[model samples]
Target: MIDETIEEIREMQTHSSSVVAVKATRALAELTERDYATVEEFERDLERNVGALKRANPSHASLYNALQDVLHSVQGEADDLDEARELTVATIDRVVETVETGKRRAAQQAAATIEDGQTFLTHDYSSTVMEAVELAVADGAELTAYVTEARPRFLGRKFARELAAIDAVEPHLMVDGATGMFLPKCDRVIIGMDCIVEETLYNRIGTFPLVAAANEVGVPVTVVGSGAKVVDDGFRFENEIRSPSEVMLEPVEGIELENPAYDATPVDLIDEVITDEGVLEY
Candidate 1:
């Protein structure tokens, strides 16, 4: 019964702006499907893992923030179901629609059109990229792109899978460890922001590296974010990196781990911030 409750909580978080939703869902799913002997046993393992998760990346803060909401429920604490559900649903729905909706698609299509026949590199997974690529494919634009795996969680797989479906979009899987190695090859690099701080952007954990590499290679970096990420002139970005234990988890004792949530890219590294409404040049 507790496992069932946990899964629902996992689902709730996964579908939110908190990207950890994906991994948390995976963890909870694994717990429920495998069936731990007791809540204490499960809670012990969860506390251990979540503790380690704090170090691997920066986004873990949000993951923990979202996880807190989950744990609160598991402990039988009551939440304002109507208000909470409404906020969660709206947050996720805006992000989803930001990626797949027609108005946003029109904007993406126009942005790509501004620089027709350009090759670009994008970091992590973005619905914005998918929409832009589809539009480019239909318009017969020469759009070759590179993607970073956005490691630990590897949300890049979703981006690659979706990119493959749209013919004419040449997408390369850039290894997280070696994304810098290929920077000079692309004309432009575009990243989607999970959060924008002041004018800076917080993307996946390794986004800082990509921005530095792009600047070194003299390639202009562009960002795509819904207006929401731009908080106060500068965007507020929270990068989450997950636990190193994600690399290995054993039922045995004496093992230590740390996971981080996300990373941030400064606004200076960005040449422009493209949104559905238009562009914000930083």
Candidate 2:
């Protein structure tokens, strides 16, 4: 019954953009009503909730890709699920690969602006940023990189672990709130974006603060994103907020709450946006 509900909610998340998190939240709420009092049950419930969350927002590429991962993981051993996941992962990999062709552009631009062996700071976990770092490392640049532990999900820990596993760039894990403390240690800032407006990029919620801090310190920040993430949003800004349950599993009665998933770094904050074709300044 729980799996059935999860599948249904997943479909709903696929079709609906605004309600993914809410649907995921309610599904877990229902599971709790079943008196799923065991730790395993709670863990399963948590997974489904996050899965639904991925289904919830398609506008944000990272979250949507994360949702695809959830589907693949839940049924990893099943032939059908494995096939679907492979196809999806392949598609994303192709897109990332194609976009990363622009890294040369960044590298060239970076050479003009930034020297080798310069440390940098970034908030949110960016696979694009990782790719760039890897490219720079391959060129023998010992760059120190800071990744934020995007909390409520602790996705940043995943980044730190992956970086350590790479045996290349230096990856430091810092709480989102403490990014300002380390901004001075880096030469410049770089982040991967899910979407770009002008030169600005949209990413995880706490990304805005880090960008702002970097800007105030007179550091140039670069945004890297794929053209596929570009859509006519028809708005100056878009922010994806997460479910309140992410922060409060058990809230006080009658208390209002808001949990947002993401925010934007204004176009003015970014120096340029790097894409596959080349780099753009908007």
Candidate 3:
């Protein structure tokens, strides 16, 4: 049953929105309530399940932090399996509440950076980024958004549509390759991160180049995410490489297709990171 749950989580991580993936992963903590003979057995099973989830979506620091929070909370707290199970369930509740609250706080903090008559460039779709922009619009800021058509999945198109729905935002969709042409016209580049390792930001595959272009044009780049996305310094991190089928389905002989789902943006290129706590200057 645990194996099936992990498989379901793996699929969700690949296909669902990040918020959905995170909430679904938190639900897995309930597995602790199942029958177990001893606390040691429960711990072992929980660790294994969490490990599987980590391997399935290594780039998601928020998911890792949530599981780690629960794991640490239940450690050595109970002598019996039933007590351990209760403790794990309670910890999961706290983690979920903290995650939800943190996201809202981060969104508000990021929105503070937006101003009227400013043009912002963004790549890919991020719930945090969208929420921040929406909040800024609500505050009566007139803004323009230049959205890249992030290829393979075209998530940027979805972001553009969302922005177009806002009366305060003028949304323009451009090809991913044309970011350099558009960067000079934008006041700032605002994007969302999947994780932050040390000072490096990991995000959708095109983000690094987007940062590079913004930097070259003297435009500041801002990253918006919850503090939970920051991973410990020594944590081993790996990028997720997606299937070539996502780019092309046709079979070609003797041709290799590389589909990297994410890339890292060095700290030097980032102007600031806005999180639940506050703004962090890089």
Candidate 4:
């Protein structure tokens, strides 16, 4: 079961970084149910599984931090196998709760930033962004959202479909390359973050260009996600190179198809970051 979860995360079948972390933490909690002979054995197994999950998606700081929090809470603190298992489960529960609550609060804060009749241009599929849009609409804020066709996966199509269902939001599907063309039509560029390492924000591959275009047009960019995405520790972002088949089913003989999953955008291009804590001005 844990292996399946790890594979789901690694294959990018999971929806978002927040969902991935929640799924991972729940998987770790389930691991405690298995029988173990000794505390040492339990510790080793826990470490192994945590390492595997972290490696599954190294770009997700939330997952890394969640696993590390569980390990630290359980490691050397339990006197027996039962105690270790208990500690691990408890820690996983706390981490999952914190992650979910943070996401909810952050989404609410992001929604609050949306003014009535504001036009927003967004990239890719962000659960937080989706929730924010829903909340804003529910609160009677009419909005227009331009969604990019985040390529190789076309996640933005999914986002656009969801936004279309909202009566108050006018959703427009835009090609990824046409961001510059659409920037003049937008009042703001609001998106989601995978993680922020220092001064750089890493998000879906097309984010850099979208942000660059938004900056050029003087459109304010707002990134919304849990503060957990801000990696302050030793966690580093690892770019995933997907199968060329994802870009094109038929491989070109001499053409090298590079499908990078994410790209780094300098924080300077972003005007604000909305998290559970509050709005952070860049």
User: How many clashing residue pairs, candidate 3?
Assistant: 0
Best prediction by lDDT = 4
Output the TM-score of candidate 1: 0.62
Superposition error at 207 for model 3 (Å):
0.8
Cα lDDT of model 1 overall?
Answer: 0.57
Writing each residue's lDDT as its tens digit, candidate 4 over 78-132 gives 9997888878878888999999999999999999889999999999999999999
Q: Residue 152 in model 3: shift from native, Å?
A: 1.3
Candidate 3 C-alpha lDDT tens digits along 123-172 = 98888889999999899999999999898878888899989899999999
Give the higher-lDDT candidate: 2 or 4. Answer: 4
Superposed model 2: Cα runs more than 4 Å off: 1-56, 61-115, 198-200, 232-239
lDDT of 1 by residue, 196-275 (tens): 76655666667888888889889988776555445563212333334466656653467665555566677888887776
Give the true-structure RMSD of model 4. Answer: 0.9
Cα lDDT for residue 63, model 2? 37
Question: Candidate 1: lDDT of 246?
Answer: 61
TM-score, every prediction: 0.62, 0.62, 0.92, 0.98
Poorest 10 consecutive residues by lDDT, candidate 4: 28-37
